[model samples]
Target: MPAAMTIDLSAIPADQRDAVAAVLRERDALKEINRRLEHLVAELNHAVHGKRSEKLSEDERQLSFEDLETAIAEVEESQDTQLSSKGKTRRPVRRNRGNLPKDLPRIEHVIEPASLECPHCQKMGGCGVMHKIGEDRTERLDIVPAQLRVIVTVRPKYACRACTDGVTQMPAPAHLIEGGLPTEGAIAHVLVSKYADHLPLHRQSQILARSGIDIHRGTLADWVGTAAFHLGPVVDRLAEHLKVSTKLFMDETTAPVLDPGRGKTKTGYLWALARDDRAWGGDDPPGVVFFYAPDRRGENAEKFLRGFDGVLQLDGYQGYNCLTRPSRKGGDPIRVAHCWAHARRKLKEVFDRDGSEIAAEGLRRIAEFYRVEANIRGTAPGQRLSARQARTVPLVAAFGEWLQEQRLRVSAKSRLGEKLAYIHRHWDGLQTFLHDGRVEIDSNSVENLIRPIALNRKNALFAGHDEGGRTWGRIASLIETAKTNVVEPFAYLKATLEAIAAGHPKSRIDELLPWNFTPSS
Candidate 1:
């Protein structure tokens, strides 16, 4: 049996007490290093073997566009229920069909045997069955595009012959453009082209030319630019409505802009703000609004979020602190939340770099927290909070203690040290979700929302200017928020644009907003 290594502190002489403390500190540091190595190995093994880890291991992640009905149906099927009143059983689509006997009877003979006669001997010979080989077949699930029809309105005016007053009976109802070449449908097409399709004006002109439309890209661009200008009031109203929500998720990404004067491009930031609560049913399901700035200073976020109050959940961006900071006018601070995914990501990166055993263990413990939340996804916010509180709070505390101990053992310049620093720095915000039932464990839902923009940015590169980027933000906010709320973006945009053109009251624009509105069946 090993003797208990205990020193009687009371009996230690005054001169040697400091020496004893130093020895104890060194012993503890060595123990921490050994523990970290063990944790790193365990994390590597878990990463190799776990399904959840496989999800995070992708290099170039693809954003999947899931059909809303299909997703709702999936939710229904898993619970052995139906989403629709028809009560049909919902089943998941099979990825691969199981093997069937090759000799199974066919509905029709795939090959009819052809009698062969020998050319040299004139004797009937049995024909050999041959199947032609071709290239390996690749398959994709087929989808049918929705049938679209444009309604053209023609109003004929007649003079009043009986009154002899030679007055046009009635002027035709006004259109978005009176003498302009583009019809309402044409304008809708152009808007959809520029915004939803991400096709630049020049590219669209060439495409129109291929279709014999003979419209210049400048004309399309002018029309769009004019439309966006005229719709400023509507956009402003939408932004105001979105900001009124009690919670907002925000993120930013780089957007490149063309500069004709400098003969070089410049980078800008696309700042987004939204209420991203898809799991919770509310007036604010999702309300994304975007802002564009030449620089990504904290002030840019401050400008967009002015007069907005309530929780702002975000990754650990210092810029967001500007939003949550107390106003000079003596108002409440913007409530802030830090994402757990960001913390986990930092640790994951460190573990990848240093292969630290402690980092791996920390990740495993953190992953267990996410696993509990995953099981309760889409449940009531209260239920999610309760589950997390029960399962996550303890793990987080232990992880924090572990981190503090490991921080002292690792080199301050090492990757492990950086991970510890990041976690420690954001510890308060990371754990704040535990106290609020409405808060989520991570900003993943908003991250999922931002991913599409990231993909689009990769393809289109950037917006034309700050105004162009703001337009992108405005449109993306409405569209992405509409998507999150299960409202078709194009349909919503088309209807909202029409309403705005018809002089719909700016104050009542909330009727056209994404989260507050639903599609007409």
Candidate 2:
């Protein structure tokens, strides 16, 4: 056993020094150990299982235009009967049915000045000839031609042929593609189709070629990559601005990456973070960000949160525990609050597997706390705190007591025991928010932020590689963050691209951040 180093209090002033400095150093060490234990318990209960199988990525069997048309036909057949019934029930009586015109007639009326008289009629008032005005009725399907129109720049020029005369010249107008094959609309269409609409480049090329555009898949790929490159710095600037926010939520989901070496794809995680008020307040919109990494390693989180500060609310991923620790270099450690929903979710999962009476009661009590939260969700922060204290603090206290009592009844090895342990382990951090008003009860804010990416993932399948995944992270960060702040994403993207093209300095690009961006009216 290692002996403890003692302090001599007799040499030091009684008010300035402790009599036993190293007496409980082991106790201090146990504090961190306990924190780790708590983190582990929470993580074990909330662990997600299984990735979507790669065999499920068949493009041919998935819903296509014909399948969609068939479905639409079925829906229309069902709706046609309802439509007939609706018309019979609500249609007004047609009073002029018999008098209605078969064809709108040419009722030509003639008039003349009072001074003029028709020679044939010999009238002093007016002279005119009645004639039928032709009319036609028809209907055609409205369709715009999908043809490319070339811009012609015919620069007509002349030069003087006299001695010591200067020559005149005309320059050609600039085109998006003087030598290339894509137009601005084509670029926007491809980007929106791929990233926003989730149609793959190969699929888009096939669709375009079918419509008479001789575009290749490789050309579309170049356009996408070039766009991402041009847009990269704008994303970085947006990310820098995202760091300055006070509250944050974080989560991750699987993103498949193609591996030609393995003759298949590999599973990767798309890690996302956000700051928003949706779960807590409907009035306050959210700013979101996403980052993709190959693994769920803690260093990835560290990299993601490098410049970020303030409260970071996350699920029960032990990787985030590293942020709570003191930095060896300097400054305050990033404060972390574990999500209550995450803690509750674990217990719910176990409850689903094996019905436990104790877990049931605990959940019922926790649900009451959420009920109180929901009631005051839209109120001001001070009022929310007051209501929480008045109504919710008692529930939390009673729930804590119930948890302590129930912890004894469950078996240590049983699933119920694991769930109880999870709730007990993070009890302090879980309740920490009751004291501070800024911390949220759950990571749902970030979860909501990442949902669009999840939807896109379902449709597009996965990123091609790690670099492609990073691009996903960068683009999602800007677009989603812009969404929270109510800034038009394309407008932001266009302006950002223009700035980058104009050689705007990177350090000063923070002014273009979504929250700070002032949009044109």
Candidate 3:
């Protein structure tokens, strides 16, 4: 133990000493946390830019930095949850822009009479001449020769006619890709098509070739790589921002990575951390961040969530057992709220395999819990808690009584017994929602967030390498976070790229966050 933790309570009276000792202990623990964080930051700096780290490629460094920031952000968020109280946060300032995206080129055509004579002159029995007063202009979106159109910027030079003088013209604007042909909108389109639409680069390349653009797959990959490099900071900031919430849903999925040595693909993992407070009427915008790792080790989770002490609503993955174990102070490190969907899925499997009455009754009882949840969603937290207490408490008690009764009758070695045992093992975690209505009946919120990952896996087959998986995770986090906030991914990403090209200040980085984003026309 550190000397700071060992305090002498001898000078104070017994009645007041315990309270003073408790506060001192908390203060010391916080100090220790701060020291560890500073040391961790120093180590990361050394590892990232150390003498022997020269072998890493630029793409690998980009991916690693994004993942490293995720871990840093999670630890910070966890610290915030445990140390601070909820406070009103100021929303980002909205930008005033037109509905139509600016800078698209326009072509003009006009119709005019051959002669300046009014046709009404003969009909009205009077001589009259047509004169131009004003013109009505109508604009319509038109696709030119190809689906993709080139935007040419012109700078008109002006100088004195009589005397020689230096010509003056506006300076060239910076682009997301410096000295490149693609627009920010074009790059954003490619990203949305690849990640959201799940059209792999080869197919997108083919599509572009047909459109007469002739961009190769490797070139498209380069564009994606550049976009990921710039957008990585936004994802890091997002992950850090999300961890500040009191509760979050977490889950992981397999990501296949190519292994050169084995000549076969290796298994990787993409972990998702989610926040959706709308169900309980919280004002914060919903978001999720995806993290890629080499494997699904519990240490990865611990590293990702080193300082988080908030409630985590997740599935029954044994990897999370590390969090439930007693900490140095002999108290639970984190609140592990188990998913009821997982518990019920076991019963459904047994019932599906064998027409068992026990499994049927379990499903029927769990259904009641969901039925109650459906009604209270989107209400106030207090209202949700009160309703759960009134309507669902009895249902839970009756279900518990019924479960214990069945556990005694069923054989220990039987298939039904095993399913019942699974539920019994996770009984405490399953009951977490009974006390707090802010949590859901299951971890389905995060489960829904990974649907796109599965679709992309089917389309792309596997990531090119482990670092590629990290790149995939970073880009997908922004796209998916945008969807949750009802923001269009392409426009949000385009505007984001435009800001980055214009040198958006790091201090105002939150303004680029999806929830704070205002869609461009």
Those runs of model 3 whose alpha carbons end farther than 4 Å from true positions after fitting are 1-146, 157-167, 327-332
Which tens-of-lDDT digit does each residue in 1-521 have in candidate 1?
Answer: 34538878668999999888877765555455445545555555555565445355232422221233344444444334322223645456556644444544334324433644334354345444445555454344445433344456677667776787665645555566666776555665666666666676778788767666688877887777766765566567767776777777788877788776887789888887767666654545566666788888988887787777778788988876766655512236777788989888887876776677888988998888888777877777788778878887898888889888988988878777877788888888888788776788788766776676776676677777667877777666667767777886666666766676677786676687676665565
Query: What TM-score, over all chains together, does every model reach?
Result: 0.70, 0.68, 0.71
Please write out the lDDT profile of model 3 over residues 1-521, one tens digit for every residue: 44654557897898999889777866766676677678668767966977434445444566577776777666666556546533423234334455545577877888887877777895788778988999987666666642677899898888888888788888889998999979999999999998999899999988888867788899988999999999999999998888777888899998898998899999999999889988888888899988999999876777666556678999888888887777412233889789899988888778877879999999999999999998888888888889889999899889888989999999979989988888888888888888886888899889889878877887888888988899899999999999999998988999999999999999999999999998655
Ranking by TM-score: 3, 1, 2
lDDT of 2 by residue, 18-73 (tens): 42443344344544445554554444333322122222323422433345445544
**lDDT agreement with native, every candidate:** 0.69, 0.67, 0.84
Off by over 4 Å in 2: 1-179, 277-285, 327-331, 502-508, 515-521
* RMSD of every prediction: 20.5, 26.7, 29.4
Q: Which of candidates 1 and 3 is the stronger one according to lDDT?
A: 3
TM-score for candidate 1, residues paired by index = 0.70
Worst 10 residues of 3 by lDDT: 85-94
True-structure RMSD for candidate 3: 29.4
